[model samples]
Target: MTRRWTDAALTAVAPTTWGTTYLVTAELLPADRPLWSGAIRALPAGLLLLALTRRRPHGVWWGRAALLGALNIGAFFPLLFVAAYRLPGGTAAVLGAAQPLLVAVLTVALLRDRPGRPALLAALAAPAGVALVVLRPGAGLDPLGVAAGLAGTAAMAAGLVLTRRWGRPPGVGTLAATSWQLVAGGLLIVPVAAAVEGAPPAPDGPALLGYAWLGLAGTALAYALWFRGAARLPVTRVSVLGALSPLTAATLGWLVLGQALSPTQLTGFAVAVAAMVFGQLPDRAARGRRADQPARGQRVGRPAPGRQVEQQAHGRHVGQPARRRLVGQPARGRLVGQPVRRRLVGQPARSRRQASAGASAATPSGSAPGGSSAAAASGSVNRCAADGAAA
Candidate 1:
């Protein structure tokens, strides 16, 4: 499939799966076992995917993959769970909405992408929408949970940038990367889960279903889709769409858990979706251009006319310095245009000797006869001497 279609599909799918996170958390999972449940969601499914794909990531990809695993899964998963556990659900959800703003800042600092005025404005709207939909009075807004949620969002943003910057190397499919991350994250969290909630009681039937969905669909499939979407779309816009996840979570809370979505919250969701659509549009000028534009064509990608001329002038300046350096030293190339006067122009023999002595004093290097002899006679021997010194 074309990258555009695939990216759109993946973006649509990823956030939808993510919307299920709250449902799985509040409805199905055992209370006070968020850490263990999160670990299970990551590790087994990751290993299973790895086994199915049977592909190994190579080179810097190994380290990059592991780092991504740590950021997107290992660190993020537990932190998210903690935010949900420690804070009011609405509070955690609102803070999570700040991802697009984080992505824009990171893209500028890390990716060197200039997210121009429109993208910046659009990115701003997404987080505002998130705040509108999720923040509420009396929500457990602790310092740690808020920090964890924001940091988790930042980690996910960084992971997206890293993934996009280092695209999947040849022969490494999406599933392999997803699987390895899951397994890596799972392993990293195992000890923490074991230590904190050793041998936790088994979840009931609905909880098991929720766990399975969170594990198989939310972590594995959602991440696979997220990475795939991120590879093709701008990272900032992808994070903007991520605003939908929390809003969807709230809507599901209303429908499935008898929670309420106010008119203001619904408006926030619409604004965020609008911002995402606006931010993701490609630059028209950047497209429809060839990488290597041919000469004598109106090549859109070619250097500007003024720049081309300036570059040529600069090239001549460089070449002129080299020719001057060769003048008082040695000439490897043919010196075909020397006039008789050039050899002894405007100076008596004694004065030339004094000049040569002065140059030799300034240079203090071995004198050679051939290429640079003319420069010495022209009373500009220092030009060649300077070039020699520079060399």
Candidate 2:
């Protein structure tokens, strides 16, 4: 019901859905069809969303959408699939784990967001945890696949930062924004998918089901939630959730495939989960930080407008520089027989204090401060001080 809880729920959905992707790809989808797989996954989901929402991107948004698609979806998907296909799932997950660090750097460049201590710690901890959860000591990598995986992670990170930077257009809902990127990404995938993988032969039931699931759940729903979180939350917080994908994939393998989880694997998973929780903690201290701090040109402790006006009035009437006033010094108001001479806005108190001391010392203790002999003769002790003040 609350916004924070709603955003947390939405944030969880993005990476949790992504976790199922690797398992879905290896188990259910057609093999050796990365480009085609990407196209099929993105295009149909995008088209369906567009049709349902009845919204098309306008003006430069068309190009912007295409660019985001290319980064987040088109270029990212095929590369991701290639890595997943070539590397063992664990190795692929480790490579994907690098995304949070990449996002931290990109946030600085794109969003101008300097990662705080927690963000930096989370960035380091997340990948280490993922490595523990997924990367086995014996796990090996392919050169090209390793390159593809790292590249895809970087692209995804950049896209995440950019999504936060260039948020959705006015009046466009999350579904519409997701559709635009998906469509653009899908279109980019099409020609490549055609040239490289071509059309798929008629699929049996399982493959068809896999494709349907990948499109509807993975691309459509996952991206909808991902982009929504990116638009609403800090990019680092959104990307930190990426750690869940590997954790999910590893857990599923243990659960569904009946793989025995060694103690080390369990430890790793626990560490990753801990890191994920820490990463999601709200960095509330950083908010409103810039406001209390003044700009470079701003004067520190500057007087208010009315105070300045009062200073100006004093300057005009008294025939003295405003600097004669000292803001912190005791008031000069009606010192028993001396007219006021204290400054209220500028200059050091040392000079004024010395002058006051000289004036005080020169007068006799029996007389008032103004040293009026007539007030001394009056002999009314209270009125003597008052009469000398008037004199």
Candidate 3:
């Protein structure tokens, strides 16, 4: 338990910082220049990472890195900006909250990965939790914003699955891989930002600070932690942690803006946090494996060293439970319905009484355990003994 939490600590950094993205966008960044903000956030950070690492994508990795970056950053950044700007923060948040579900579904469809019930339920439950935290009676959702939000969610989900599937190449570190994606994503962002918004005024002090923080902490550091987590942990587990982002956004809104959190908001906050924590738990299959393994001090089977020797000594494997043996009975391992009509060694094997009794005990029709050799072996011995006594 401690170990899982400790390992997830870096992954936790990404979403926790991301929670502030909404806050920074709303409070600090200039209006009508979200694309500019995204570009500034990603490009420089990516370049800095590239400069620091001095590594480049090799061979087919160039294409793979581009695709990943486009999904996670290029398309995702612009769409996310639209969602943040056009929709009520909570409405956008609810849309963002659906990311885990998309990731879980895509993993199942593409990777053939099955998420445990807890992770699935937590993912399904997150939107409701976010709605609770941020939704108000007057919170109106915009169609364009909703579409953008969904698209961004999908883009990020696809990127996450790919990150887990095609991990960092040999000799390339996690930071280097992160830099590759960022550089590609940032480059993609460049033309789009210019074409759509043309060029925005030079960023003022607050906007500049926001851009610096986003580039340094949010984009570079956050993605480094994200790919690191995805590389090591199950994709579903890492995705579930994203619930923290909306929760963080809501808490920041309440505190930073001095807006009071209502009773319902508080309840929603607790639920969201609880769901994220619960979703990180090991799946049922993992838990079952751990449970089935015997304690180190106890012996459930033969020693690992002696298992092969034991198998060699006996024609049968030692691990398999031995079948019960009937005394003085033929060791043929099949169920006998009745005495054979043919003679054995030119003499009848059993008397008429034995055939009649054998037929009475078991019918010709038989299955595995229900009508198997077990019943025939014991029944035959008892009937033969009874006949001998009667004689």
Candidate 4:
């Protein structure tokens, strides 16, 4: 349990650090260079990781690496920056809060993993809480920014699901795999950045420091932890942890930027935090139900041995007691559709002898009819019973 929580905490650090991106971009990074921002953030960290790990993708992993990188990093970063720039921080964060829901949907569609009820509700509640915290009554809605935020959220969701689906290759560590994706995504962004922006901006001391912080702590360390958690945990659980991003951003705003939090905002903060905590809990109901269920091929409510036989023989209802067999009847092997023939118990041998003699006298000996033969057979059976009794 401790280990699992530790893993979750580490995974959570990724989004928590990512929450600083909006502040860093606003304060230290250059204006009107979203593409350059994305390229610079991704490439250096990826290269550094590649240098440290000294591993490369082999076989189909190359394509998988590129695809994952494109969705997670290449496409996600620039679009995220665009949204951040175009909309209010609260509005951007609110849009990003939809990530959990997106990831949940993709998980069901791609990985075929269904989330529990608590998780689904948390996914919904987290965004609503974020909205209360960040969204103002008259917040401007830029169509381009809204589209960008939604698109970025979707790209990240797909990337997260795919990460869980494919996992890392045999013998590849999280750092190595993370490095591969970073490099692939960074490479994808470079040409696009160059084509769109024409020239990259030169960084001053603060900008460089900001870039270093982003590349090392935000991108490299964050993504490594995120992928590590995704590989280890359920995708739904991992995705919901992203609620920390906006929460962390709000916290930083309050602490660093001296922003005031209203009572409503505090309530929202409480709600979002509750949702995140709730989302982490194990699905105890599902587990309990599974535990209570019987294993495969196991019978339930089986009848007792004698009762089972009686049911088969007489077509009796289940749970009914077995009926006692009649006197002089065979213990087993009663043929189907045969009539039951029984005799009275405790009858005297003298009576049986008298009955046999009478039966023989009634039958005609010279020309035997069906009735005479039947009477003779009955007398023979009675005589055998009398002889046994006398002996």
Candidate 5:
């Protein structure tokens, strides 16, 4: 497939799979041992992909891959499950809504790109939507649960940014980068999950199915697609599309788990989505700008006059004078008719004096006998010519 379609498919697949997490968590999975489930979901599956691919990372890629793994998967996935287990499903999803806005803000710092005018407003505005969705009087949602959700969202957002900034090392594909994170996260969580939750009573058929799907499809396939997109597109744009994750989860909650969406919740979803769209638009505009930029070595092979003429042609506005002033010309071209006037005004007084002297030399000298005036005019013309030449 073309990279664009591949990238879109990958990005869409992750959120689609993730949307099922809430329903799976509530209906099929064990309640108290969330981290263990997360660990199992990540580590073994990641290693299996690595083994199947027959790939190994090299040199600094090992350390960089480890860091990438920690940021994107290891830190994010388990913390995400912990938050979901602790918080109400809808409230947790609302915290996930903050991902796009957080990514847009972080991209400005991490990638050094302006989030643009609309993005600036959306960055401030989207959090209000998240607040409306999560903060309620009788929901029984604790501050700690909300905080954990926010922390996980932030970690994921930062991970996405870093993934884009420092992509996988040469000779390694998306699977390798993803595997490192999966293994690292899974390994980190194993002892913790074991120490805290111990071994659970054997899961029933549906629960076992849930764990299998979460491990293989959710952790492995979803990340594979996510890394594909991260490798190809801006992190902010990727995060904007990821807003679908919460919506998907909400819809799945309604269909599978019987969670009803209130009008306020719907409004929050709509507003947050609009802000994400707003954040993404600037990146599309920037992509166009980069496309318009002169390609490498395009100017080098052209002749000097041709290059200058091309630059002038590129720089000039339509309906302007053909003989535009050169770069050093005073009164730079800005307003209409100004450059022509500036050119005329800037013609040195010495030029006119030289013209007058030349005129005298061209005509007969009426005032001097034996053409003394001719000699005098010749001297003046010479002097003027000399001065013009010197000046």
Candidate 6:
């Protein structure tokens, strides 16, 4: 449990560092080159990680790595930049806030997992809290930007779920897997950046510093930690941590840019924090309910102790052998090899008594004159019937 929270905190660092992207781009990076900027951020980090890991994907992992890269970084980064450029920052953030909810739905559809009630509520509450923190009055809504933002959110959400689903290939570390994705995603973006933005701009010292931070810490380290947690933790839980991005952005604006926060923003901050924290907690009720369930292939209930012998005797419970009579003992109310004798329905009582006396007199010693065993078996059957009646 402690390890789970640790992984969550480590994973959270990715988005928290991401919160600084707006500030970094506005203050440090070259202007009017968002595509080139994304390419720089991804390509160098990926190359650096590849150099360090010295491992490559094999077989199906090659295709899997490309798909994950496209969703997580290649397509997502371009769409995100488009949204940020075309829409108001507030509106873009509010749209991106829908990621947790998207992840929840996709988890059910793709992974067949039902998130707990708390997780579902958190998914709804996270977007509302983010809207409060980042949304502004009369924020302009561009159709293209809205579409891009939603697409980016969906892409990232799908990437997150798929990351959890596929996980790291055998014997490959998180760093290696992250490197594969970054490299694949970076390679994909290079052509688009070159086509759209023409040549890369010469970076000044501050721009170089900014690129290094975004590449090494933001892209490489951040994604490595993110994938590690995704492999170890629930996807919904990890996606909820994305709410921290806007909250962190808002905080940086206040501290670094001298922006002031209103009471409503502060309230929203508290609510977002509360929702993220609540989402992290283990669902004890869900765990308890799962614990109460019977394991697969197990019987639901056991027979009563008193009925076990009878059931076993009839080959009903454990398929034991049928009950056997003891030597010289009778079954039911008759000797083992003898036919049952019955009196006529309307026979007189006196006649019945006389017949019984005659049979007993013939076996005075409780044994027939020539067939002692038959007489003994008959006596035993009669005793057994009387005992059964008493019982």
Name the candidate that leads on TM-score. Answer: 6
Weakest ten-residue segment in model 6 by summed lDDT: 382-391
Model 4 per-residue lDDT tens digits across residues 1-391: 7887888889999999999998999999999899899999999999999999999999999999999999999999999999999998999999899999998888889988788877888899888888888877789999999999999999999999999999999999999999998999899988999999988899999899999999999999999999999998888888888988988888899999999899999999989988887887888887887777765665666653454532322344445454444444433343322222222244433365465455446655542223444433333322222122211
lDDT score, residue 320, model 2? 31
Error of 4 at 363 (Å): 66
Candidate 1 lDDT tens digits, 63-100:
87789888888888988988888787778877777777
Best by lDDT: 4
The TM-score obtained by model 2 is: 0.74
For every model shown, what is its TM-score relative to the native structure? 0.71, 0.74, 0.75, 0.75, 0.69, 0.77
TM-score (C-alpha, index-matched) for candidate 5: 0.69
lDDT of each: 0.72, 0.78, 0.79, 0.82, 0.68, 0.80
Candidate 3: count the clashes.
Answer: 0
| Cα RMSDs, all models | 12.5, 10.1, 13.8, 13.3, 11.9, 11.7
List the lowest-lDDT window of 10 residues for candidate 5: 335-344
Per-residue CA lDDT of candidate 6, range 38-86, in tens? 8899888998999999999999999999999999999888788778778
Candidate 6 Cα outliers beyond 4 Å, as residue runs: 302-391
TM-score of 4: 0.75
Off by over 4 Å in 2: 284-391
Clashing pairs in 2: 325-343, 325-344, 326-343
Report the candidate with higher TM-score, 5 versus 6: 6
Among residues 3 or more apart in sequence or in different chains, the pairs in candidate 3 whose N, CA or C atoms overlap within 3 Å are none
Each model's total of backbone clashes: 6, 3, 0, 0, 1, 0
Candidate 3 or 6, higher TM-score?
Answer: 6
